[model samples]
Target: MCILVLNRASMTNEQYQSARLSRDSRFDGVFFVAVKTTGIFCRPICPANPPKEQNVEYFTNAHMALEAGYRPCLRCRPESAPNSWAWLGAETSFRRALTLIEQGALNQSSCEELSDRLGISSRYLRQLFKTHLGVSPKKYAQYHQLMFAKQLLHHSMLSISDIGFACGFNSTRRFNDAFKKTLNLTPSQLRRHGLDKEARNVVYLAYRGAYDWQSLLSFYQKRAINGIEKVTDTSYERYVEISGSLAWFKIFADHEGKQTVKIEFEMEDVTKLSTLLTTIRRVFDLDTDITAVESHLNGINHELIVHSGLRLPGVWSTWEAGVRAVLGQQVSVKAAIGQLNLLSESLDYRVSGQLVFPTPGVVSNADLSFLRMPQSRKDTLARLASHLREHCDDSPNNWLALKGIGPWTVNYALMRGQSEPDLFLSSDLIVKKIPKN
Candidate 1:
């Protein structure tokens, strides 16, 4: 496939060249540099000596580079680059499709099935991928699967067979053949050496731009559910349920001043690894392009944004977020957290020595009379849980139709649950109380 160069939507090729020359971390995942002489692609932050501008070409994303017949540079490890929304353009359908693919939509299903989920034809979906990303949707999905498997091989202590299964390969032989054919490297050859000293459950997630971990951590610490979550000086830990089993995941911000954070998770059903990682990314707001956000905010008013690396601190799921918002209504953060703990303790169960949050089904059937909250709030929680169970949709708009749910609850769910970027809290007391200067 012929490669598509940098379009008007993205930065100019000269800017990209300058970024590669300076090894700018901000452009790490925004664009990839492929060397025509060597037939290899590398992240802009790759440490190798820069290739002459005449000999290098730029692709919008790693998939595009791979589709252009360039093997990934082993030194830069393009597989571990931060996932970027910059590469996903303004096409809402395409963006949604990409999100679904990352969440393992194509793992056990076909592109037609994926498009069916999006209410579009498979052919148009392929055209969207081709127009925006310079590759077919299937190729993009396969690239992600392979890249994720490579990342696991180089970082995690998972065995090769387990990695294959986790990445959606049915067997070891198929995994090996596909790995060798695509990446031109055997799984064993790509696995990092000296694994004995590494944390078996640990993997580093890279990000671009400044990340205000302290601020985000403090926000979580103040409102954290005591038994379900633990926020400390340098890390955030929480118990989560994955694939019907109890699991716990933690993020450590001690990257020694690097633009990456380490995550450690332990769970059953390794096949659900992709789903777990997707949730972790959302919870941390990893996919945000903070530079763009800051630029836009700065244009509106320089004083509007206070922190350098501000991000949306998202909840694990819409259901959990809805419950939290319902319990938090007309109460202090401390009181809301207490109610959350009470609800979890009453309905939650323990497995593998970790506590898992109560599911919607559990909350729907239980009479939450033990909590020190108003009856109306309890009814709202029940109605929300029942709506979730019956409709199988988590859109915030749908919640507005339910009784006892209002704009605040829906907006809270949208802001925290989905990490929506644009929201104006005119009805908030604090927002309204601010002096009109």
Candidate 2:
């Protein structure tokens, strides 16, 4: 029953005008409208007086608007807009390239290196970005970094220098220069206009549409790994490992609205912020296009429409998902948790009260005689661990070839592990029991 709008880049002039006039929240990130008179671009939901059709120009993204010489509206903070899910266009290479860009791909390497990693030429990669996003990969990455820096300025207590480095800027001077060049304001001036002083190491993330918090919490609760993760009625807590250091973070929904989630962490290294935020977005499926998902599910089941915001929860890592899937085969959820908890307790690494899941090397080398599972399952686990350790660049096809991993397990892992939306478990007993039309 959800009304699906056309992709932002494809929206007609009239459609953009209508959305802007009405101040529609659904169109917040879809496209931004730049007022020629004011020389500022604002999210569709901005409360400012609407500009006349002649003075307003629609931009597919904030980057495009910036390229057109329009400054971001301070009142609307286009930087705070939920990411446009439509940016993940139809091309596989485009999506993968975008993902890499979000992970600070250009900060560490050139476009040629990135293209080499994606198995495409640098020219073709540039073409993909220009064709779909209307900007080069470098521009997209730069815009994203600036946006993240802006978010930190408005939300965190980090100093301007720290915020710059945290957002992937190589030097404080460069960060200040970029801010002044792009927004006509210094970092400190922007921070002065931010919300109340934030507690150290906390950031808020925005998402579009109505998020089914209870459903998402329940999903994590059912699969919560002892010593590694915990799900409470109000928050989810987990231990995270980065650069050989272990830290904990907690996530809870904002009580004021369903549009944002708060992430509180105790990480000492600010440079890991980009990687951590990317993982959080993936784990929560914050970028899903709920309207498109509902339209696709409309013919199959009416109930699915009612619960369209129920996201596909993702794991912290593919290795964790695969290991959990292997442990869960043929066992009840509770039984699998018991075994997993025991395995974690037996592992070598421990921080606070939490245990880092054993690495592939550790799992493959450790003795499994203590586990109560069958010998065949134990052997399968060993083989999987060894395979993962040896083949660091293994694909899903390689995963499918491993012993004791069936189609169901592989599909389940892909769905949660890689955030693949199209994989459905039609053979699941619960899915099979659903009434047919």
Which is the leading candidate under TM-score?
1
Against the unseen true structure, what C-alpha lDDT does each candidate score?
0.82, 0.81
Q: Which tens-of-lDDT digit does each residue in 1-437 have in candidate 2?
A: 12347565566787888888888777778889999998999998899888899998888778889878788887878887877676555688888888888888888799999999899999999999898768899988888888888888877778889889887889999999988898888988888887546457778877877778888898889888777788988789888776566677899865468478888877667777888888898999887767566766786776667665778889987777888878878787888878887887887566444577777788999998888899888888888889989974466557877778888778877888888887888766667788986
- Candidate 1: worst-modelled 10 consecutive residues by lDDT: 1-10
lDDT for 53 (candidate 1) = 94
Off by over 4 Å in 1: 1-8, 87-89, 192-197, 351-353
How many clashes (backbone N, Cα, C below 3 Å) per candidate? Answer: 0, 0
Model 1, 198-226: lDDT tens per residue? 65877778887788999999999998876
TM-score, one value per model: 0.94, 0.93
Q: Report the error of model 1 at residue 148, Å.
A: 0.7
